[model samples]
Target: MSTESNSRGNHSAENGSSVHHVVQIDASFLSEVEGKMEELPRLLNRSAGRDSCCIFRVPQSLSEINERAYQPHIVSIGPFHHGEPQFQMIQEHKWRFLSDLLLRAESKRVVLKDFFEAVAPMEEPIRKSYSETLEFDGQDLIRMMVLDGCFIIELFCKVGRIVPADLDDPLFTMAWVLPFLMRDLLRLENQIPYFVLQKLFDLSVGSGNDDPSLAKLALGFFNYMVQRPLHVLVKYYEKKGVHLLDLFLMSYIPDCEEEVRRPSRFLHLIQCAKKLNQAGVRFKPRKTHSILDIKFKNGVLEIPVLTMDDFWSSLFLNFVAFEQCYRHSTKYVTTYATLMGCLINTPADAGFLRDHKIIENYFGTDKEVARFFNNVGKDVVFDIHRSYLSKVFEEVNEYYQNDWHVRWAGFRHKYFDTPWSFMSAVAATVLLLLTMIQAFYAVFAYQNPPKNH
Candidate 1:
């Protein structure tokens, strides 16, 4: 009887423990469901009021095309890629930059603490600008803004020649690093708010006679990297940008012309430069630094010279990614890339542009240069009707579509495409010229007979 009672009691105890475990799990799941249910209304409200997203993840569809171009290799700029293990190498450099900035401001008695104070209050507004709610709390986000903003200012200062570089500075002394850093800084996900940097600039370095506006400084830095003059965009300096990436985007747009209306969608498969050359379309190099200054008028297609090197892909891909994520942003860069892709379908097309001085290929082969454009627009969806290049595309396509243009192109390719054929044509021209001169002399002698006198 005692054994039976003990067994029964043990069984009852085991059953109770099992029941308790099940109840606990049920309670935890119910709590989670309730929490999500409670947050639905607030989430909807937040979604409705969202205006612009400063930083964005490169769309996975585009990223999968070439992950390296969308991702940072040597450095990560902002909070999205922050704490990444591979990017940790640059964190020390960022800290060093921060230290240098503090020391430079020592005379003004500005410390790191001052940066924190300025950034902390602006944290909420800054967060509001991001499309996705950040996983970081206020303190963490502020710290990131402070550190990243200072690093960028210091970099721009160095690049803009506003300040002298310290001895053994990696950014100045290590040549390869500058390109990577510049590429990384322009990534869509790799950016901090420009206002934070500007605020920090005022707090640490007063806006005095020598201190330039942040726009000027940023333009200077971009111009240095691109080796193009972006001074035309100085008028738009007072315009607000969400971050450094947006500032970079804004630099490409020229002031709107009153006469020209941008179309929504333009054709892409216009004749290549080589074909266009045959059709009597003149390719002239525009001396402007604005990348979007492509204009087609009266058979002349004016395009700014584009330099292609190892770093161009990284810089360009990031710009396209930004256009992809933002609805309100203009698709200028995307349109340009698509146009280039259409125009440069092969090495022959790239060589034609290179010969015309419209494209300056720094170190890449013609095929590689051609490939850059051909692959750049993959997975990026754009409405041609709303594109800045729509009008240019329409004009170019219309011009190339003429019956005369096609016949002329065919004539050139058949008769004058090869060197031997061109030489043959030149020889025939010389012979014809001699014959015409002989005929003219004979006629003159017969008509005048004045040579005898």
Candidate 2:
């Protein structure tokens, strides 16, 4: 485990126990997701739920937080603030995936065509006049990024024949590409940038397949496992009373950043320890996906930077920084309830549950989580997976009014007993707004003249 102390050499952990980090992740916890076959129905429920999400295998490092205690009741639902939904959520469950909903949209086919026209060459800086269709001239930066995305998904999800014997096979080199690609990825806008990446591919076999996006997501997670949390790695080692930050980073950081393969800005994180030391800040061991609970507060403020490994994790880190780093962070508001869910689950499922108590422990209480999820619609969670199926297959009701999602939301709500399906629907409603905008623009253009300009 590479850590911060080793890098700073001889720095003392004078008040180790009191270092209350703004976050805490049981890295060991996420690995247990494969065994979560039972928790799904409860989390994806359409009604008020009381299923305990307590995993049997959490690291003993921390005690089980008393489940947020609150009376379950009816609550109203609302829109998705989350980025594009993941493909895994689609292929495994069919229409439940947002991609399918996107498919159901009126201008879906056209939008997809537009998406392809803007993206499809497997090569980068696509030849403006390439006679061949779907073929890129050569690997451009975008193409390289797309490849990296595929490469990562191949590592985390489609890792064929990756057994215990090959888990550490240096050849895979997932870390090398993760940070390099992500740093560049952050430089652009979200949806449009993804549109470009999507267009560059030729998924003739499965036209609507979003395997690349799934790959991008998984790689994002793998990168977090490999890097960015070195400071936390240091804290972890410190807890065990052994320091190895310098040696660990020197040994693996270079490989993770792939400075040997391709020089990148990521290398600076590894080589620039002196500057961080001068500034007197270092990342503590990862508590929960790079978020940790620090007890020691010696006036050293924690800064937030996106960790290339986990998209959700990076978002959570920034979310915490928004509270801890911001000077205006209200003194009354120490932690938000949803942060706990983000800490415990994937980015997609943040506050998606119908039960509020499950998310309130780290955040504050059951009521708070319910209020947050209520802001989005209910369709995201289902009691039996049946509602999910029904909602996903339903045609995009074009006749529905602007607040139709809200209007149709009647079953038990999130705040009280609101139906989870309607809530998710509301969220989908907002995300799908762009399509409506495009339609309006097209209609306006057809009606008005270009006027010989």
Candidate 3:
């Protein structure tokens, strides 16, 4: 009986030791969790401060359509793509451009130190402009801001003829290189804040009463891509933009009244260009300040002439991506792309628009243009009631649904589509009338028994 009692005591001791070990582990885990909870406030603080984030990384749903459209090919401007290997050549040119600006600043009593000092106070705001948490430290970000900003300002000045460009500078001498550089500069990921450029410009090349403003200089450099008149561009020069891409986009927005809030509905896609034409809708090319200014009046649909090239394709893709990602942005570009996609469902639809001088197809064949629109318009989130072209869509769809118009249009298209067919139709009509008249005369002669002639 004593031995049995000793064994029970030993088992109790082992059970106590196991319980102690489990309690220790639970206490340690609880302490670790409590320690991690301390960081919640900091995370929330960072998130709350992100209201200034205007620049965004393109979301995967949009980028998956065309990854290269959102990425920089020749140059890297912002932290998202900085220090990339392929951009090293442009990185060297950035230094060269900075050197030129420094030389110019020397005459104005502005030094490199002045540029850095001007941007130093803006580091926090600059960091908050990007959507992602940047890995760049204070000194590295400041240097990037100064370098990229000055290079853009100098390039604009040189191109605008505000400052003379070097005779040997390949960026200006090589025509092909300038186009790619221009495209890269306007990319979504490849941008520094416009305020940084303005600060650098004000310090390095003080604006004169007669001299072009930074906005003007920027517009001048990118105007070739858009081909807007100077007067139209001048109107938006005073408006502040977040970055170069935003500035370029701002130029294309129509200077019209604010969009009025209307009842929301499911925005349906309209018929293709070929189908609309067959349904008695007329297509006309319009010349407007903004390409997004599309209109439908009566039975005619008017669209501004669009020049499509490789540069335009890339530009539009980025523009749509930006509108999709950014909340404050208007859906003008997105609406235009979606409208085009609705109108061009096939190669024949593209060809019809091409014949009407509505689309200048420099990108590729009609099939390619059709495919481009289809691809761009996919996976986009748009509210038609908020869109500027919502009225046009409603009118076009309403017109297309009319049975009388479609029947008449189909009849005309089938019988009188070509000149030969029209002539044959007229001749057949005349022959039928003559046959009826002859039968009536013969019936009258037989019934009345008139004298034979």
Candidate 4:
């Protein structure tokens, strides 16, 4: 009995001892975690010291609303959309374009290896250009850079007529493909670095490239994409562009003048075209091709002619996204789009612009154009203070808000909206004038008796 009691006592003692055992944390585990925390700041400093990353994934705030807007519809260019199965068909065409480019370069003694070697050294810088670190190895990246660079250069040459068009070229032969390609190239996700293209062009064409500079050829190609017949005034400034979308944005912004001075603050509520018209304000299409150059003077708002097409919404949304993403980038395109959105609230407003020949609507009905302007800037955040047309908007809005302007506008709209109404107003004015003359004669005759003389 005593032994059995001692055994129970020992078991209880063993369990109590096990329960009180202390855990010892390894010093190495703690050190490793602390080391990682210490390394974070150095990593950030290293990234900051490097050249600013240019290419970026579309901010979720911008892309989440319309994921398709940033995606290429017809073709993919860079690593972001490289492996998508839907865009795989165009890879063959890119290779074809590269082959054609080499054939054309034969006269300049340029071979495929020369192009590949030229782009090899640029791989590191090119990878750094993208905001997100690309996960491609040296060989894969170099190959992508070479192929994409050649395809872009060849495209610009073909579109600008720098090289003779191939008879069986799909881009030229198929009428529907060109417009889609233009839209695809301008997409935020589907862009290669412009430097890559320029370098490839120099290597392939030597000094034989017709255009004086690569910028000129690129601007010319942009004009073709927009289908504008006028020559765009591209300043010979050394602004480094991140991608095709960046280039397109910079085309409208003038050098040395980043922001237009905002007019002094006042009631800035710009009326629609119909309202402005009724308020005795005039609308005229400016001869310039820059859509950002909207002006107002002497009750005349001179807006540059805008071409609206099937791709207008996609083009505009991407432009807005680019402006939203970049810090140094101006909100000129955003402002222009907002102004258009303000001016055209409905189909009637669109018709008013069309009647003034300010907007060429190649899309569909006025409603579609109106809706296009209204929705293009969805999820896009912009500051009006930075808009170039701040002053113009202020003036237009203040002018439209004056009590006299409102009354006159209302009167004109109420009484003179149609030809019959205008004629009736003229007739009433004439009758009032005759009545006043008769009354004056009666008063004069009764007071001075001038009739007797």
Candidate 5:
């Protein structure tokens, strides 16, 4: 019995020993954890310095809807897409552009070393301009900035006619290539900081009293996107922007004071074009510089004519993605996109807008245009009450919800939607009135024989 008890005690001791060994942590593992913990403050500091970051990689949620909209097919501008395999062909052109810029700069006594020296001091701030930590080393980043910046400035100069474009230049010779390049340049990821471009432009081109600013040159280069009046471009040329994309976006924003209004309790989407038309809401093409300047008055909704093409689609998608990702950016483009999505639900709605001349659909069919808006507005989140178009939305919805308006509109649409239908209704009313008059006279004649004589 004593031996059996001793055996049980030994087994219990062995179990306890096993549990202790399992619970024990290695000294090396603790040291490694401590090392990682030490990195936390450095990581925090690095993140904190990224407040100036305006350029971003489009979020996966937004990009997955349409990857081509955010990606550059012709050229890679910044570190986000640098060294991409598809962008290799454009790299040769970039070097050629750089050579041209250098030749032009030589007359002004500026050299390659001057550009490198100018950008080297700005490497840290330039790196921080991007949302993500760039993997390029100091030298590589500086080289990219000089090379890319020079290419863009030179391209802008040639396109803006500040300098003559090479007669044999494929970018100019090929009709399709310049449009693609313009689209690529405006991409959110395909941008360097505006300051970098400014410095490079000033160095290479040497700004003069008569020489247009880089902003002007850029606007001129991208003018085909909107074809706004020269005065409009001149007005926005002096406005400061973080980058080229921001500059282009700023041009579209209306120069109106923000209205002081209480936030709406709940957000609402206005009805599509077809429903609105059915409800007697008239759509007129607004004559305004800003596309966001949509107005509602009485029973009419006036909207600026929007040209929908592949370039505009890509431009708007990136604009919306930027507004969504960047906190400091105003949600003008996103709000416009959401409003467009609400107003175009199907091919019929698109067709209605097309008929009204509110939407110039260069995109395939009405169905494709509808799909474009739907895809753009997918998964987007914004505060409708604070939107620039909030009042427009509220007024439009209120007008649509009125029972009297709907009934009257329904009556008019059912009866007088066409000129022939309106004429028929008028004739029928006259005929009914004449018959009533004849019946009254007949009743009088029957009641009094003398009156008949």
Candidate 6:
């Protein structure tokens, strides 16, 4: 009866019902067998905790007996992009890191003298990748600084200056994505603007780095691009509203040579919730999954990462796949595709209307923007001389006629013309009318008053 009760108790514990059990063991058996423990196996086996008994299968024998056992409690944490040992802390650190970099990059110096001094640090940090085995050539940095078109190129050729690096050691290696975003910030005049992004990708594919340091950097950099577009291309035709996302849904790049018609990098981004109100907002990863859930509940970010499903229903098909291709290596494309496919197959919000609202407006309306410039001073407003804006718009229209926006606009035109297409709608209508009339006459003619012929 005791054995039965203990067994029932174990079962109850296993079911999580919270039960208690008491077992009576022979004390003399333990004392007598204490010295010769090998002989005390029977007595030791049945002694255990509050709810169950510890059964010992006879040593070296597969004894199949039905006995209840208490299971050890287990908790699991989700995988993260990098050192997201804890999601909440990681998130806070991410922004803190960004603000620090921004101050160094943009706010540190304003006057021409300070700007020149800042360039000294920019030439190259005294030490690059102090924490990891990363080696950054000083010249390599000039390439990054001159990311914007005319400004960077002209500055490199004309100014020909050097800079000292500020950050000596980073707690974690910044992800490679961070470089692309910084380059984007340089105003998109990079000689090989997307080259950094591609190189990071290559690293992810085969660099065999266990940490994915460069990959994480790339993610952070792109996040910055979401907020600050490379101004040089901001006004360009094919480039307007284009993002760090190098590929489009219908874009022709493949994650791997063996892959075919795969998803683009843009889709995975939406699925990631990296963007807030369409602007890339910064976030840090969590150490544990539950913490991420709690943070999500509190609405730390403009949009919570967990809310990805809510937005998935609204993504454009090709765009969603585009993002998946970047989110992982080509080897995982099929798997990513399967998961996204499930979402695609389910009922979702249709998010395909190409938003023509200019990127500037999306940031804030003209009134607010005007106020920002006015506060900056009259010179700041005059800096973009109408001539400059006009020239930029004209050049972009001419050079990038086939850019994403331009192409999308052309497609919109084709779509809008459907009603007015003479050969399509009008001709089809005429043909339909003629067919109907003939059918009516044929049916009536058969009954033609048996004319009297």
Q: Number of clashes in every candidate structure?
A: 5, 75, 0, 0, 0, 48
Which run of 10 residues does model 2 get worst, by summed lDDT? 71-80
Using Cα atoms with residue i matched to residue i, what is each candidate's TM-score against the true structure? 0.79, 0.19, 0.87, 0.82, 0.90, 0.18
- Positional deviation of 188 in candidate 3, in angstroms? 0.8
Model 3, 1-453: lDDT tens per residue? 366766776787888843112123578898899898775442123532355767777778888988988898888898889998999988999999999999988998989999999999999989778877787789999999999998888899888888888888888788887888899988887888888988898898786786678888888898877777898888877767888899889988875532644663433668899989999999999879778888899889999999999899999998998778666788889989999998999999999999999999998999999999999988999777777887787788888888998999998998899999899999999999999999999999889995758
User: Model 1, 183-279: lDDT tens per residue?
Assistant: 8878787877778888988876677777688877876776657765445756766665778778877877765431344442335547678777777
- What does candidate 4's lDDT look like per residue over 1-453, in tens digits? 367766776787888843233357899999999988876342122332344555667777767666787888778888888978887777888998898899988998889999888888888778766666677799998898899878877888888888887878877798988777788888876878777877887887654544446666666776766655544534632344777778777777643243555446552546678878888778999987577788888778999888887576678878887777666667878888888888898899999999999999998899998887777666777666556677777788777767897787788887888999999999999999999999999998888874545
lDDT of each: 0.77, 0.28, 0.85, 0.76, 0.86, 0.29
Using lDDT as the measure, the top candidate is 5
Candidate 2 per-residue C-alpha lDDT over 1-453 given as tens digits, one digit per residue, 9 for 90 to 100: 236644333243453433332345576776576567544333223221112110111111211221111100111000011113342221232222223223333243433344333445523223211111222234233433343333322333323222122444433455653343332222111111222223322231122453333323323333554554444333322121000111121222111110122232221111111222223322223234323222113312232222222333233222222223222222111222222222323222323221222222344343543333232111122121122111211111111212444333322233223456666867777778978999999999999969995
Q: Is candidate 1 or candidate 2 better by TM-score?
A: 1
* Alpha-carbon shift of residue 296 in model 3 (angstroms): 0.5
- Residue 405 in model 3: shift from native, Å? 1.0
Stretches of candidate 4 off by over 4 Å are 1-51, 207-212, 229-240, 254-280, 444-453
Off by over 4 Å in 5: 1-22, 38-50, 257-260, 263-267, 439-453
The model with the greater TM-score, 2 or 4, is 4
**Best-matching candidate per TM-score:** 5
RMSD for all candidates, in order, please: 9.3, 30.9, 5.5, 6.8, 4.3, 25.6
Q: Which sequence of candidate numbers ranks them by lDDT, best first?
A: 5, 3, 1, 4, 6, 2
lDDT of 5 by residue, 229-284 (tens): 99888988776688889999999998653353475533377888888887778999
